[model samples]
Target: MDRFPEAFKRFEKVVAVEEIETFMQLRLAFGSWAGRKWVPTERQIEALNVEAARLRLEGAWRRETIVVRGKPHVRYRDVRTGRFIEKPF
Candidate 1:
């Protein structure tokens, strides 16, 4: 049985789920006719992941860090309410 969606092969959902920055780049690339037909190389995916990590570390898209039961955790922010939330299931 497969856990990932069928679109995962094209990285359509994979990139977005793994990293927002990568999704943004993927979106941009798909905006063009030529780019839409292109498949990203593994190196490109790796680079996107690295860029996403760099942005997160720099707080560009600040995910809130919270301490729960003496353990530190990070979560995405709800832009509408400015609240941190657990991973969306």
Candidate 2:
């Protein structure tokens, strides 16, 4: 019995599902991007600070240690790989 056609269809569905899952995971992990004119207003900044303080209190903003040039540099880990990287900007 030749089940190649059905198998291929199942494989295609699996690949599509995997791709969608990856996209959703990335979106959740990195968040949406802001536009060029998206400067935070005073109120927004204050709100952000409040949220950040909440996260900090929850121990979510813990500092990470990294080795650089034979010295330890405290930095945040990259979200994708859990590796320390310098801030791009």
Candidate 3:
């Protein structure tokens, strides 16, 4: 079966070759925000949550949640920047 149904395919975008290798390295490092080593602050976390909720309400298909530090946090790729944001819990 197709993991991403046809209806959801519109949300997918083609990533650049430079981004692919960087993305893999970051994933291996365990989902950092744009591959940054430091953690996000409480204010940033709250902002990310709000942004995620807003995106969902706007019918964005890319908004998602991920577990970090044993708690659920919002994760989304900013359309304007093309950067993966995994807000640490």
How would the candidate models be sorted by TM-score, starting from the highest? 1, 3, 2
TM-score of 3: 0.26
Per-residue C-alpha lDDT of model 1 across residues 1-89, encoded as one tens digit per residue:
13222333455533443444443554354334225544465444334434444444222223567799999987766433456655422
**What's the lDDT for candidate 1?**
0.43
Give every collision pair in model 3.
Answer: none
Per-residue lDDT of candidate 2, residues 26-60 (tens digit):
22222223234335454333333233333332212
User: How high a TM-score does candidate 1 get?
Assistant: 0.28
- Model 2 misplaced regions, further than 4 Å: 1-32, 57-89
Candidate 3 lDDT over 1-89, as tens digits, reads 13222312222232222333232242232224234633455543443334333433222124567799999987766444556755332
TM-score of each: 0.28, 0.25, 0.26
The CA lDDT of each predicted structure is 0.43, 0.38, 0.38
Q: Which is the better candidate, 1 or 3, if ranked by lDDT?
A: 1
Error of 3 at 25 (Å): 17
Largest TM-score belongs to which candidate?
A: 1
Indicate the residue-level lDDT of 17 in model 2. Answer: 26
